[model samples]
Target chain A: MTALYQQSLEGLTRLRGIAGAMVVSADDGLVVAESLMEGIPGDAVAALAASLMRRMGTAVSAAGFTPPSFMHLQAARGALLVVPAGPDILLIAIGDRHINLGLARIEMLQAVEQLG
Target chain B: MRALEPWVEQPLMTFLTESEARLTLLMTSAGQVVAQHGFTRAVDIMSAAALGAAILSSTEEMARVLGVRPFRALSHQGESHGIFLSAFETPRGRWIGLVVYGQDTSLGLVRLFFDRMVDELMAGVPAEGGPKQVLAQNFESELHSSLRALFGR
Candidate 1:
């Protein structure tokens, strides 16, 4: 793994309840690097999250809003959080319901800065 | 979009919706068209199918000479557009897909959805008989008829 992705994923995985963190291509949804729990399907997560992000970006812009910087999808079992690292890259986190959103957000922002 | 085979329509449509591909062609490895989308003329479809099949065949032969397995897929990216070409197995036969995408979509997304579509197509294909044969004697007529069906001309 590249230092940028390894550092980002490693930092995100340290948080409690966080199942995985991945550096994904926003354009293609391919995982660049990941620190995923044993059962987590990183490829599916990256692809679906990137697809959702693209759809949401389109909808947001069509509603006269600027492109979104961050997005969250909370499910019954887990949650997905995405933040743009650059025009073509994304930082994504998968976590349980008890995960700390505030801390995760801060860590993700720092990771994005490192990516820059 | 139009499909010479009815079963191909739904899978092709689903692929288009998910991948956001601007143009797509699904054909046999032998260059016989089974379905197509976003093509305005018969000549374009025929040319693309022939070229795609030729490219895939030549690449496969090259891989053989190099003692490597044939490539799973090929892609070319440009400033404004990108093309993805891949071959997959089906109950019917091996099929090729040629996709053209723009800024709104990425190759990763296309490939992901394409894999799903292949699975769907494999399941959805009827198992009543062996694969259809495209004989040389009827090739031109079949091509013209398929084109007419696609364009309603």
Candidate 2:
């Protein structure tokens, strides 16, 4: 599990415009593993990103809408991309505006499936 | 259909209206029906629940540690809009969520909703002891591991 998580992070780094990546447990919203940039606060990002993921899930439920299979939070500084690896697993990516979003998403989807 | 006041109260909701507010589905955190807007009527309810469940569990856990509060996600579906917002309690599991779906829903708007919804839920509920110390410790470690993976350092 740990090795695979590490590989996922490295894969994120190899992507263009991406700042970093992390493997988080959607069940607990805690970072299981990570790969980040210099001086960047990896812990805070993971925590906050997990928090955001939870928030997105709840919002989907309350409005009488179908639950979200995955969440994609995009910001000006960069984008927070989340995908479910399995029942309790998630793959998150933080990237700059220039990142090839469609490509990154495809890569992440493939990576997450591999974890599954 | 109803007065837009309730819907307009949330910026995220409005954003969904402007966006792909044509095809979408709505639901509650507990797998109940609150509303369902536009879609092919062939939407996958299970997928929606999976998405909501993942988010709900995480936020509830975070609220416990941050000493803020808990919230739930509220969804609003439009033709092209897709939004999900969850509000939570500080330490003891009390929150709400509001999600909106549409084409014009910007990430900034979604974030704005997140900030406001947290504030709203926190204010609405009474304070409580944050997550247990032991649980917090484990969560902290988990956070570290995940972040390292995210950064790929």
Candidate 3:
């Protein structure tokens, strides 16, 4: 892994309640880099997250809003956070429901900046 | 979409809707068409099936030459469109799926749904005789018949 990718994933994975962090292709949903816990199903997560991001972008644009830079999906058991790293890449983090969204959001934005 | 086999229609329809594929063809390893969607001409479907089969055959051979297992799927992305090809096993026989998608969908989404479609197809397979064996002498006739059935020509 490149130093930037490793650093970005490591920083996110170090956060409390974070189950995994991945750099994913926004267009294809392929995993570029990841720091995942056991049994996280990284491939599925990456694909679903990218799909959701695409849908969100389309819906938001159709509504006359700019593309979203950040997205948070909170489910009953977990939450998924996504930040666009670039036009074709995304920074994604999966965590438990108890995760600190404020800290995670800030760190992810910083990581994305560094990645850029 | 039109299917040569009745059981394939539902699964293929589901895949077409979910994957947002602009064009799709389901065929056998021998290049016989089973179903197709978004193709306006019979000639185009015939060309795509033949090409897809040949490409898959060559790639499978390449994998053997390299001492690797045969690849399950392949994809190519162009500026305005993309193609995805994959083969899966069914109770009847091996089948291939060729999909063409545009900017409205991604390869990841197509593949994810393709896998699900494969599973559904397997589950929906009729518990009876296997596929009819196509003799080499009858291959040309079969191809023409399938095309006529699909296009009503």
Name the candidate that leads on DockQ: 3
**What DockQ, on C-alphas, does every prediction get?**
0.50, 0.02, 0.64
Tell how far residue A28 is off in model 2, in angstroms. Answer: 3.1
**C-alpha local distance difference test of each model:** 0.87, 0.56, 0.89
Model 1 chain B poorest 10 in a row by lDDT: B134-143
- lDDT by residue (tens digit), candidate 3, B1-153: 999889999999999998899999998665568899999989898888878877888999999999999999999999999999999888777788999999888888888889989999999989996766746555466667789888887
**Candidate 1 at residue A62, lDDT?**
97
Alpha-carbon runs more than 4 Å astray in model 1: A1-4, A55-67, B131-145, B148-153
Sort the predicted structures by TM-score, highest score first.
Answer: 3, 1, 2
Q: TM-score of chain B, candidate 1?
A: 0.90
Docking quality tier of model 3: medium
Ranking by DockQ: 3, 1, 2
Pick by lDDT: 1 or 2, better one: 1
User: Any idea what lDDT model 2 has?
Assistant: 0.56
Give, for candidate 2 chain B, the lowest lDDT window spanning 10 residues: B1-10
Measured by lDDT, the strongest candidate is 3
